[model samples]
Target: MKKMIILFSALLVLSASGNQTKAEQKADVSNISSANINQTIEILSTSNADKSLVEKGVKHAANLWRASDGTEEEFTAFCKENFITDQAEKELVFEKISRNIEIITGHFNKITLDLLEPVHLNTFEQHPIDNAFGAYSVDSHWMNDFYQNKIAFIIALNFPAFSLGEKEANAKNWTRQEWAYARLGDYFTARVPAELLQEVGKMAANTDVYIMDYNIYVGHLTDAKGNRFFPEDKVLLSHWNLRDELKANYANKNDGLEKQKMIYQVMQRIISQEIPEKVINKGDVEWDPYTNMVYQNGKTIDATPEPNERYQQILNNFHANKAMDAYYTDQNTFIKRQYDGAKEISAEATEKIFTDFMRSEETVKVGKLIQKRLGRKLQPFDIWYDGFKARSGMDESKLDAQTRELYPNAAALEANLPNLLVKLGYDEERAQWLGDHIAVDPARGSGHAWGGAAKGQKAHLRTRIGAKGMDYKGYNIAVHEFGHNVEQTISLYDVDNFVMNGVPNTAFTEALAFIFQKRDMLLLGITDDSPQKDALKKLDLFWSAYEIMGVSVLDIRMWKWLYANPEADAAQLRDATMQIAKEVWNEFYAPVYGVKDQTILAIYSHMLNSPLYLSNYAFGNVIEFQLEEQLKGKSFPAEVDRIFKQGRLTPNQWMVEATGNDLSAQPLLKAAKEALEELK
Candidate 1:
């Protein structure tokens, strides 16, 4: 999820063109026959008697279409072939599938041909088959992004979870009935990617068309060309999956005033647990609570933590880091004192300085003047380091032309990257290996990530470099993204999980990337051991933690408000969220004046699109601080490289195993504040 971004950033403020009129084609659904009902039941009842034979038996038994190749034509054909025109017959058939457990269960088992994997904790059983279901009738990008890769991804989900010792299967679980439910219970989606209301309105309004039978629908989203728009990485999906995350995360005053930790605890508990059941209405009995953690079933969570000592430490570290972060916010009166530098400048002057930076030009007064305007937005880094100064040692004041003009993109400048990574921590071999992977291209949309040969388990990874209008800041961003691409390329391709890959969480990967990004100064051969350079490093940590931590707060508070008043409209929700961020800004950064428009922070689309993800930014920085503390002089490259190689464990688990300390915010905050105090 390093490429994690919302489809709605510009929609918030900067309205860029995204008016996609969905390829105005409607889809239809089907009717279940008695043969269909009986066949579905048989498949669910059976097991892996003959893997190959079962495939032949499946189609012979029921008229099921393999969405294995979910193309627009295939999807459309699926809809039309199965669609029932007679309302009475359609209801009768759908009722049979819905009412009979065996029918639904059998169908679910059959659909496993498309999804259902071993390590994956999700299974969107019966999806609403429509124009959106990977249809490539009019487009071919679907071949690369969807059909071939999409089906491969589905199969990837089937990759068996790597268990430690045990190897045998059939001897464990109880019944086929249990397996049927287990297969369907793990994953979820709201049927279609479109708004639930929109889908419902369409379904109800149009009786002529059937978008396939609703009874066998598995909730999955697809784009016009029929590609899964979701992030491909499973670990990233596990941490911040939009649909799955928000469904359980809801907790506002109206529904419940549960704290985030409590909610997070519930979420953690159910990692392998069954779904929690809540009463739909006063008359309804409690639906069904999730069973319990697979790692710990039928026992009290307090009974005994799982046997993984390393993971326990990770949990401990997570708490410690969060506790330390809390301490930094509450520690002293220094936080109350204003930066007189900011107060010295007027709002107009501050805006002018900021505008100059935004316009990609030189600014003599960025530190004081810009800080006042940006306020909490301004971490200590914005104080002195200019993007222009960062890349080109020549002063921004002296360089009259743009940064690209001064430092042209040439074979000469390409080496600046390898030299940069080596300075940070990479060895000669690793640096050259990574440097060679560097690649550049004009990007579509706004952001970029590791693409080309550099993405996922393919020995050759092209470190995809996307450049947005040439500027010093853009160049710096390109470098930062480059570090991320390198880390991702190396980790995904070089690490063990080529078949089962990617970091268990985006945070750990981000920490590695940030480690590279933070080296911008040191990487460029600027070795100022002075208080300013030291201050710059410390400032970078503080600023990194500050930005992400603030985002976490916003996410936490918004979710709080959202669940509190389930009835609130979008306007009410937006307004209340704005107020929450403003107050948090005032508290965390009251010292910095001219900090109007705190609500701008609320503009971060991640708050709406990516639930509970921002905290990782702060969390990653804290981990980096601790990792850096241990690796300061003692074989940092070796230590960090080994740590990055262990991909599958949770962040906390990884940290505990690598470093003695639990995930605590103190190391980063303490080290940073100490550096700040020294500067004073």
Candidate 2:
């Protein structure tokens, strides 16, 4: 599932202007000193309340107060006035805040979904006004409004914010209500300007539009010798469809290698901004990605390369995020916020996990096994080798024909949702309930699952469905997104706390999606009974983990470079990104592929739009492996319900509860090694 846009409810709430330095951005009036907090606690402590409760409430409120909020005296006054000392009253306050936030956030999410329909769904012809409305964030001023009403300060006063470190160390003892309170405390930690928040949302929407429309007329692509390989009517969106197309070609018997090489070249052109500007989303031109040449109506013409537009998108996101850094006193950089706040995993820990797996000897073995299976030396693009997949050996055309016939349109797939779930071991009633909660739609771009924020609101499963039918590739992606819908429904409707409505992060959802994706064939009534199936599954997962971990490292390094060179322009960023990709590839992938300095790692579209999200795929794979182990001899529906309903725990804690192990590559690595030995 694609990560949803950062909700306006989650925007920064600090008082600093965008231009202020980090030091200058510190809370002026709200910065309550330890002495002041102690004095306030003493003053507030009376026969009605315990000193500890007063201290917790005062300290928490003081920590959350901002200069723009009011004077120090006002902060004290607000805390004393709003703090709920009586146990029954405090419980009531917590319930009110939780219920109110759910209503507010849920409505805002629904509004955004409805407004973006033109852009996100293919229900109608999109207009300029649609894009404008899609980009407009309804919740942009929500934080500001809450602060103005003093509601933010009240919540902050009652529910103290917990650091990630504190959560990790202490949350094992926390009740569901306590966890909800901590999440409430998380609401007002930053004080970014509303306009800046709006700008960021607009920038993301613009980027989404760009990525969605970036389709390549695969049929129109020509070779240096003026030969076209793909079907005349076929179109592939970058880099999702393009990458999947390359994977699909593993079953092609004629010129498959050439097609893969051509696709790799096209990816390189995209990454380096060397692709002809006219070739993108346009079939009027036929181009050779290798020779950097274009032709129209059987005549060659000079064409300008895309003018670093790809890098500019990245730079725009960087600047928008950077502008708010001063307001995030605790997690200042976007990198910090993404890991510590959004991912709830430290950067150091995530990096260590990714690097450890990528550098493992098991990865080397897997690469060698893949090369042996291919009966050729490894190319950088072999990172996507699909030979291990059972579907790779089947004719893609036959599968496409089958899928197209079964799902002739979006409605066909939507109608079959319950059947799909039932095939995966869900009972008839449960499957119907899940299906009812998830609405399927034709996507304008590659498909994604947009989860609903409130109960009774349907989570949308969007996938590309052609006029003729949903093809095999689209079907595969749809099933994956369907998994997200399942998890979304369970996590939201069944969870004990409203604040904890999703998984720990996108990765956990991705893991469930993978589980669903791997069963697409079963859903289609196609079964693979090969004895080597289990081993192949392990090897495939291992290889995928290896490939994405390298890309994740490159993504991390690219962002780090951007932070270091804040003044760098698009062209400069492009150079740095390519260099970072190569460096990461050489260090990790080169030893296995025996190919050095490949820029293929930089070709993921998520790096440009999602920002540091590639790591989640690698993490998801590791978690999926652990979950797969736990699911052995277990009920699929029961396990899924039990696990997903554990909602929004820290990743490691969730892992331990679900799998009786921490998130680690070791399980996957060990399984892959054993699989390789069996295959040998």
Candidate 3:
């Protein structure tokens, strides 16, 4: 997941007018008419300096100026007083605002991080009060307060927001400072109320807590005969750990297929919300996922199925985001805000990218290769096929043992960060410096990296650590999160402009994480001397991309389904989501996997919590492949440092600068084709 601060930033801003009462509508409308805008523009034009920028700024300010802000005359006067036309003075003002905003937002981020500690980290026992604290958004009122004091008006007047098209079209020739100006201009695009922002924040926090706390006691899972299939103490979180465990079982010759099948059944129950309520996060009860039966003390008992809580949570999110529709006249729907506003990539373009990749012949070809390797017909769960990875053939238990012994806890991993970076080609001093800026925490959920909001604050790397130690899966995920920390630290501390810190989007960060994750074996000092290593890596990237692209497209379709049926209750939403999942599967995946109507695509927990985020993983795979191609013969550390420091350009511009080409799936597809031929 991206930083919570960054995610909430998406929910805070929306432009124009929508469904409201007459009085409310009047308040939302800009009292500044065209006459006021023209007058302000004319007054500012006397300087003959930054002529186009000044005009754009004035119009933008007028559009956002509300009746609550000031009268038309006062609006015009404020713009005339605040508009900075002198080049040097404007730059200086930008710098000061940039520095101060960083301080304000950074401290706000720290407050949230501190408040959510009990909920997000394993530092202490969770309590109801902690949830309240976690959900209490301190910065929710910041924008509203700014608007009341006309600070937002000043910024909007001086630095107007740019459309994605405008930034992309002109970014190639722009300097770093110009890019920073564009980003600063993006600060205040709309004026959502503090109440609406607070409501969304509470919904998001609650949903996240639900997801993180959802644990499935796999050890208690039984077959039809009440036979246990996993270790007695084994437990896995829904979706992430379960999926990883399924992937890990490929090396278990004794019962790998059966385990995968069992996990697949468990996932089906979760998506359909047919799993017993007592079994969730409860180790005291035993359940047969295949039969959907619950047992206590070896006696069968009537158990209630989860009462559509999963669906209700997502519906709650929909309603929370939907309430903001009246405020966002330009991008009315939450879907539009998520894609175009937050991800800065249009939903249509993102969907096209995934669908195009899915339709490629290489996808089916790779499925056939996996079937050949497995010596069985492909199952729906084969989407997680792990044979292409370098470590696939190695014993997973041995890897787990090694990882546990190598790093027994979060502190161990924290101390070893510099060593891992040094192995990846960083010098000792630089590695130590980078490590010092990153903090490690035991995550309550699977794992995620939280980037620092300011220069001095540390980026947090969080992963699950057990009583024994960090397992191979946790270590692998931690390494990925560490990659995010590396990028986060570098981008924040190394970028030329404060406002330009961080990558263009979460996909760019995920790209770096994937890049680091692929080198897990090397980081463990395990060398792959296989001549086919390069080809295998290509196939792995291709297959992973193919799998997630389908899920991402499914996510998009589910949201589209919800929009079409906005009055949908939880049960109705469940049925429609299942139908949409089947439709997507049958269209894109059935031929490849030789299966029809699989709801596994709906199994991602992200669909319920992080709306419209699955596409980033798909895009990350593409960007990672492109960057890997770029890094083939270059200095690893130097290239990564230089590329990440480019910071927050549009997707294509960032790709072109980093890899000498635009972001596309073609490179991965082309490589996978060659890999299949070579392996054959």
Candidate 4:
């Protein structure tokens, strides 16, 4: 039987929304100092070693790899040398987490330390020729999905116990979180095995070709609303569709394209219909089934604030459909544009570039040409991850001692925000207005911003800072992250339950945050309208949207595949995902590079950590493009800031205020088309 969704993952987050009083619990730990913090923990977690020792002897013993050039087996042996039995077992994943801490210790504790080197994370372009077991490699997207599924599974499995409280409830019904978890878990468990099969089929084909419809399973099944997912009794389902001129294995041009468009249209229309309902009833879901265990639903899904129910429902419905429909409707146009313009760089030219880059004497660097061949890299797939360290214009060691200097944690960001805003080009008045309106605080945990957890009110802004340290290399992320905090702070603080929080949906928030983030360069002593204004804005927008649109495509397809299968197992899910990934890359991505069946995009961690978040990046950039028009040359409009201060307003209304327009693909496509068309 299906279980309840408990939102345990949500509760696991000790957010300000949590019932516990954080102020009483959170002492000024910075006073203890990062040096003391690191040393104290080392003494506790590891001991009897020189704290400052560069190489491991005692303290570093727990996570140490062999001093010699050891193989993976030898490294494990070295780990056993010093770690307590319990600690040693965790060396695999824990060590990676510790790497973050190790760098922090190196800083003595300051987030402002310059620890990370810039990195290039274009894994999507790399996996084509990688000899590592083809698409079946766990290092591919499948691995990321596994962890994500694991989390959902745990939530589904545990929520029943949580809601029961061992006393009140039946102790064996689906709670809200458990129910949601089971729904998502059911999707993943079924998908994993299905995807595995798909991967085997691709590997068996032997030719480096893509099966575009692989992520999509062709099956006869009724959708949630009881409509047939495929018109035929048997569905020709897969994630990839030949949009615009995106070529696929299917030979029929007209019939295939028409059929593909119909599938896309139905999805677009279904989402247009279902999403509104889901959003309205989101907080409310019925639950009754008890399997190994069960929980009960508490909040009614789709319930809205009484004052704004009607308008908000309209807004909710609009927001639900707008982001996906934009792409779904205009997918053909994007494909056509790329198809007509994609340079026919043959397989020979492509491979030659890959070879030339590899054969170069320099081994420390990896460029896009070489990077595209390897699957699995950390994500956001941006330029922040550069091979070489960023230009170290400042001293790293001294920065660590100055917590008060580098946005001293999140709370300090709000405290020091006015000065930073001034430095970043905001006027004194506007800067002060920000300080007055928003409450900045450290993230209870992780990378997201919106609706505060405190006081059950949408009238407060919470700026969460989760940066381990604001190192020079990581400052870009810091600024971008703060942009999210700032937007989330403003939008939520200014509004009540009527408008409450959130724009259209998550995407609107992302776009707004991005608007602030793209200003990072400007804030970093280079004002947006400075000497390079024209070129700077163009470069930023082009790259930002260019990167996110491709991501959005993958995200949209993933959900569809999940919805279609409804019962795929882990291996099948893996194969199905890989096949879909290959197809999407080939159809949408390959032509541009004269490469086929590339699965580099599978490395996105969001594919595991947060479903559908990638789509928000694309939508956010589109919304940003439109908002940019309204914000142009305004010099920090107070009214604009006021609007932003109202957290979580619907995207369309925000657009109406910010740009006198509605949510449409026109702005996003216009920006993208204009930018790409002008590309050499």
Of the two candidates 2 and 4, the one with more favorable TM-score, higher being better, is 2
Error of 4 at 7 (Å): 16
| Candidate 1 lDDT over residue span 461-535, tens digit each | 112121312333334445556656665655555654231224434566667666666665454445555546655
Ranking by lDDT: 3, 2, 1, 4
Against the true structure, what is each candidate's TM-score? Answer: 0.45, 0.96, 0.97, 0.41
Kindly provide the TM-score of model 2 when superposed on the true structure, using C-alpha atoms. Answer: 0.96
> What C-alpha RMSD separates each model from the true structure?
24.3, 2.3, 2.2, 27.8
Candidate 4's TM-score: 0.41
lDDT of 3 by residue, 153-200 (tens): 888888788888899899799888888888888778777777767666
Q: For each of the candidates, give the backbone clash count.
A: 40, 7, 0, 81
Q: List the residue pairs that clash in candidate 2.
A: 12-192, 13-190, 13-191, 13-192, 14-190, 14-191, 14-192
Best by lDDT: 3
Give candidate 4 misplaced runs (Cα > 4 Å). Answer: 1-414, 423-430, 436-446, 453-468, 496-499, 527-536, 645-650, 672-680
Question: In model 4, how large is the Cα lDDT of residue 534?
Answer: 41
Model 4, span 1-680: residue lDDT tens: 00001111111110111111321232211122334334434543454433332122222221211223244443334333423324334234333432432232223211111110010011124343432333232212332243343332222222111111211232135343322222222112111222322233223222212221112222222233333323232222112121211112123323433333334433332222221222221222321111101111533234221242222222222222222212111121212211111111122332233223223322112223224522223222222222111111223324323432565465555566677677656788877766565444332112233333222221122222323433332344445555655555454445442223324345555665666556554554543334534433544554445445555566556555654653444444455655776776565444344456555455343443234445556556667777777777776545456656543323444466566787655554444434433532
lDDT of 2 by residue, 554-578 (tens): 8888999998998899999999999
Model 4 global lDDT (CA atoms, 0 to 1): 0.35
